[model samples]
Target: MSRAEANTNSPKRERIKRKKQQQGRKDHVEVCALIPVFLVSRARNLLYSHLMNSR
Candidate 1:
């Protein structure tokens, strides 16, 4: 199982984990970066569809 593999690989994983900790929360930053663009595109599509339908 992957859990067993990770247990075996814990030393390497720990090193990588420490490196990520030093890198200042990259996962949160990436999600934050994506959300606004996703919302904006959806809003723009809905607005365009409404405008077309109103004509």
Candidate 2:
């Protein structure tokens, strides 16, 4: 490809990459916030199971 074409494409590629990274970051933050809730629910179920077994 010509140098001019390459230079034009570079900015477009960078913009796309930046958008994807921002989306990924948002997803990660949402998942991170939910992780503790998931773990707590899992632990609660485990405890409940043990209590039921002991009965």
Candidate 3:
């Protein structure tokens, strides 16, 4: 491998790494946001099922 090739590739690789990190963070935040919604829906379903059974 040539020094110039490594030099050119390193900056591009660094940029891609930064972009990937940002995307990962965004995905994590989306998952965090959805957790409460998921829990609420799950709880609602369980409540409805229990009420139906009690009827």
Q: Please, what are the lDDT tens digits per residue for candidate 3 over residues 10-39?
A: 999999999999999999999999999999
C-alpha RMSD of each candidate structure in angstroms? 8.0, 2.8, 2.2
- Superposed by TM-score, candidate 2 places the C-alpha of residue 38 at a distance from the truth, in angstroms, of 2.1
Model 1 error, position 19 (Å):
1.1
Q: Best candidate, TM-score-wise?
A: 3
Q: Which stretches of candidate 2 lie over 4 Å from their true place?
A: 1-11
Ordered by lDDT, highest first, the candidates read 3, 2, 1
**TM-score ranking from best to worst?**
3, 1, 2
| Model 3 misplaced stretches (Cα beyond 4 Å) | 1-7
lDDT of each: 0.92, 0.99, 0.99
Clashing residue pairs for model 3:
none
Q: How close is candidate 2 to the true structure, as a TM-score?
A: 0.58
In terms of lDDT, the poorest run of 10 residues in model 2 is 1-10
